[model samples]
Target: MIQLYYAPGNANLAPHMLLEELGVPHELILVDRDNHVHRGAAYRKLNPNGLIPVLIDGDLVLYETAAICLHLADTHPEAGLVPPLGSAERAHCYKWLMHLTNTVQAEMITYFYPERMVDDAAAGAQVKAHAEARLAQMFDLIDAELAGGGPYLLGAQFSVVDPYLFMLARWSRMMVRPARNRPALGQYLERMAARPAVVRAFAAEGIAAPFC
Candidate 1:
């Protein structure tokens, strides 16, 4: 059975949603993050980076959230969570996934953990503010894409990118200019929030309302 090491509302949410959407049997191993278990040697053995999520599938141990999402979608191609390989849609899927992780998620890390980059609390506040501003622009671009694309990121097809985007967008709920504040993105979030698979994932993660 697949075992996923996770913390509630962590990056693991994307893969968790995909797993629920696929209706696959898997084990959820809650990481004791509050006690710094993720930083301990046992957890580090699974993920040297000590990230919140580490998916163990047979002999394969995966850490990165996007990679885990892609792996699940690829393994369960019948789910249609990813586009046909080598197609333009697949390329776009890769593009959005990359942009979400490398760009949006990276900026979010800065926004949430600015103290890691700055020496002073004041400087950390500035870093977080700037990151939030950049995240707003990124979400605006995504909102425009949805405005033109009609529903999902891949033009009406619900792919791995949707849940991934939802997980990231949920992090912005407390921001000054949240991703949900935009008309198109707000509607998009509501649609995602209504998904049965998404609901199950959120519930499993013990995530409360205001999910956007």
Candidate 2:
């Protein structure tokens, strides 16, 4: 059985969703952020970064949201969460996955924790403003991607990449202009919300519906 240590609505949401989609039996270990358990030595042993998510599958241990998502999808090819190996769609999956993590999610992290990016705490607000602007532009690109044709990111087929996208866009809820405010992204988000996978995951996470 796979076990995932997570805090509600954290970066772990992507993997949690994928796990539900895969219909694989899994255990959720709460890293109790409200009590700072994630920073505790036990959790740190699993992830030195003190991140909210740490996936443990027998002898294998993994952190980082995108890596976990890709692993789950690729390993469960029968679920069609990821495109076939060496195919054009597979290439597109990798491309968008990287961009979602390194670009969009990165900006949101910086946007939320600007003090980490600046020498002085006073500059944090400016850093946050700049990051939010970048996020707006990023969401615009995501909207464009959806507009470029299909219902899903990589055209007609839905992949694990969609949940990753949905989770990030969900984080955008606090933004001045969230992804749901964008036409294409709004419709896309609606579609994702309707999925049984999403419903189960959100319920498990204890997050109330009307999800972003």
Residue pairs in clash, model 2: none
What residue runs in model 1 are displaced by over 4 Å at the alpha carbon? none
lDDT of 2: 0.92
The lowest-lDDT stretch of 10 consecutive residues in candidate 2 is 74-83
lDDT of 2 at 70: 83
- Model 1 — which ten-residue stretch has the worst lDDT? 201-210
Clashing pairs in 1: none
lDDT of 2 by residue, 1-212 (tens): 99999888999999999999889999999888888998889888999999979999889999999989888987888989888889998999999999999999889989989999989999999999999999999999999999987699999988978999999999989889999999999999999999999999999999998899
- Quote model 1's TM-score: 0.98
Please tell me which predicted candidate would have the highest lDDT against the true structure. Answer: 1
Instruction: Quote the lDDT for 160 in model 2.
Output: 78
Model 1 lDDT at residue 12: 95
Report lDDT (CA) for all predictions.
0.92, 0.92
Q: Write one digit per residue (lDDT tens) for candidate 1, span 110-203.
A: 9999999987878998998899999999999999999998599899889999999999999998998889999999999999999998898888
